[model samples]
Target: MFKTFVASALLISCASAISSFDSYKKSQKSNFTQEKSQFSDYKKAQQKAFSSYIKELEKYWKKPIMTSKKKLVSYAKDKKSRTIIDFGHNRLTIETLAKETQEAEQKLSLALVQAVTFNTEDFYNNDEFEQQLAKIEASHKIATPKIDAEPVLAPIFFKEQPTKKSLYHFVKHNITPEKIQIQKSSKIKTDKVYTLTISLPKDATIKRSFIYYEDVKREATRQQIPLALVFAIIHSESSFNPMARSYVPAYGLMQIVPRTAGIDAYYHLYKKKRLVGSSYLYNSKNNIKMGSAYLHVLYYKYLHHIKNPTSRLYCTIAAYNTGAGNVARAFVGTNDTYRAAQMINRLTPEEVYTRLLKDLRYSEAKRYLMKVRKRMKLYKKIYES
Candidate 1:
């Protein structure tokens, strides 16, 4: 009887052990199935979220044209606002930026296509799924308004108008002062004023000489200022360097500054007299012509105010150096160099004019006048001879 009891106990223990192993295996299988279902749900959720975002963007893209004047204005403002960023801050160059913008547009278009193609039913099974499907269909059904419907392009939505500031910035960017030859003389005339002549190479070719001579002559004649004065001003400004620029962002041979020659002034001048290729301020001949005209105007103003032709020229040059207002104050004060210098010291933007004049080195206005006159006489003799 005792032996029978021991065998029965062993059998009961074995059965318990087998039952526990089966239970554990069943539990593991259940857990694995649950985890797989959860993973699938999570993946579907992720795809749905991405699809919703893309679909919403497409809705905007295909939205009916309800263009109000105000909306267009705002769009234009936003576009222009981006223009500053477009030019200034990107790691890449302008060409690269343009490429990037195109790529972004393409991405947006592709996103819309992907959103449309993605299975919406896989994301949801009930009312939510129906609502999303309806919304997507509605968005897709929305018609794209014609881009060319307007008789004239809206001002705000159109290409940005080039400002004087932009032109100035472009000029400064392109011209490097050090590379420019500010006062290169021609073989024909060794004067400060550059004369129109053939730019003969070290090995002269007649064809090249003729081509260069005609080009120079054409440029001179088109500018309305005497070729000699044009040369003189360029020599004074940038020494005949095509690539010449100034420390203060003055560009080209004539050193035209943005403040003086930008769009509003350019347009105003154009209304008064036609201009070519947007601006003459960058063109060597044009710059000299404009400067000469301005100098003549200053001379007239000085003669009216100061009553001396010779003194007027000096005052006008000084005025050009600083401004007419500063020069006026300088003249009205002591009329003596010491007093004029002392007076100029009191004005604003004084440093540039003072430094330039001091470097030129005249103790008095009379001497300054004499120097310019003497230079002008010498320039005429050299060029005319």
Candidate 2:
């Protein structure tokens, strides 16, 4: 009777564990599906406050679109350049131009401070309808039009942040009404606008953007990801744009996709799958933690079997931008990663690097790999310092 009771208790415990695990898996899948279904709303949230700023305002013509209003500001930063453009309602006189120049300096300072501080909560907000909509969805009322708060900020990338001037001088340019070409807008046009442009060189931009080093080093070391690589990827991905958002809808300093990279990294750190929100990703500390974890997943899990560390690093860089499947195909002409590892193993790291530069599936991926590697080398001193 004693042995039978013990056996019965063991079976009950096993059944309970199995039931709990099944419930966990089911919940994770449900969360993923629901998050994916709301992609449209979540994506729209990428644009900061929609409250009349974007809807009612007229914008200018540029490679990326911007709503040009009175004293509008925009920033473009990459590995080699930093650009800040501001629009004014009237064509500036010499005095006004000087004022605008000072303002331009202020705008650059603001951008850097935002990068340095990662204080971008104002940018990733949702409207009343979005909030209620989220609730309704949680309650499975998909068809109901729920009330959401009206959004009032600009898009995260398009949104301006805080700071003043850097040490380097800006190559300043001014554009009068005739020189400027804006996008045609249905909204009442504010006539006679002028523009101020400030262009900062690569080094100056790097110095300004490379803040939050202590946090980055801490997170990278904790995740066992290379500190230089973390810094390089951040510089290359956002050019240290704390509030940067790509059309891929990747968010924050590291440009992590909410579902894919973000979820994986969150799971790696906490053992729970979670979709990171844009505001959450905008925080530099949170962004680096997720970014470093994803890189660890890439190098240690997805690309682990490759024989050479140097060769593996190259593949990891390529995979980070493109993917493991593409990296595999680049080497062995197959998408089977383990099979490609055999081919990569036979080559020296130098050989793998050269071949990747030559044979990657997309020019953009190849360029991305190059940019990250170059920036990584550039960050080595920063890391050491």
Candidate 3:
């Protein structure tokens, strides 16, 4: 009886496979005939649809919606179709074509398994649902599965819209380092205030420092950090000193600590080289660039927790004076701005405010800010003159 049942199951499975194959072949013939009719109908329907849309557009040519209509017209023209198909409004035609084609191919492919099954009994007596279950396994057998051609992911080709990397390349290429150095130096000199008290060497490229300053300032602007804050930091750190130094041996116009910030970063910080000394710190452009970059770093670090610009600026300044780690520590167990303020007050100014004098550290950071403002006025008066 078991042997008889197995034979019956095999006969039933074979019958089902034959029925499915016949149905699929019939579907293929139907689809082929329908495809020809559909394309013909599509051409007729497309003409009618496009004409109707163009008529509607002609009626509302000057309306606000006309902009979108114009785009539709341009796209239709690009498609170069005789039919007035409103493909933009109803994409069903193309979608239907894709759907029908995929279904036909899938069905035809599924029906073709019997030829292979006869040779290899591996697929014999497989249930219809079971065969579907093994579709992934069956897919591996296909030597060269159909792969529809796709456009390569190349960069957009627009005569008007140049590539971003190309733009960067063109900019770097067209403008020689020599030209950049000269132009940057010139811009700096024009913007910088020259003081007779500090005699600059005839051999120095003072303008290069200014170039670095401008680049730093532009970067700060792009980041949306208040220009006032950057200028204030420079004022407080070195009095816009370009050549300012401190007793602790903090160097550069920005008064950057070499050991902490690393010797390698100094090149990027100043954008120029100098003999190792405190006087190099006094260069106005280098000071501003490093000072701004440091400020930007602090701004980013505390940006998530703090929302208020004024408060964030204070914490950033505190972080600048005291290490960010200490400032972060001070915020432990409290998100209260006032509490953070108290912690900042308790932290020793000496650890952070290496460049600030006694008078500047007095009124929580307000006095420091006041000094920066005062020095900024002095810088403006000297430069603007």
2 or 3: which has the higher lDDT?
A: 2
**Candidate 3: tens digits of C-alpha lDDT, residues 253-280:** 4567644432323434554322222222
Superposed model 3: Cα runs more than 4 Å off: 1-216, 261-283, 326-366, 369-385
* Tens-digit per-residue lDDT, 267-364, candidate 2: 99999765656556656777888899999998999989997988998899898888899999998888899998988889999999999999999998
Runs of candidate 1 exceeding 4 Å displacement: 1-230, 261-268, 271-280, 301-303, 333-374
| Candidate 3 whole-model C-alpha lDDT, 0 to 1 | 0.38
Q: Clashing pairs in model 1? A: 181-241, 182-238, 182-239, 182-240, 183-239, 193-231, 193-232, 194-231
Error of 3 at 287 (Å): 3.1
Give the winner by lDDT: 2
**lDDT of the candidates, in the order given:** 0.36, 0.59, 0.38
Q: Estimate each model's TM-score.
A: 0.31, 0.69, 0.31
Q: Please identify which of the two predictions, 1 or 3, would achieve the higher lDDT against the true structure.
A: 3
The stretch of ten residues in a row with the least summed lDDT in candidate 3 is 90-99
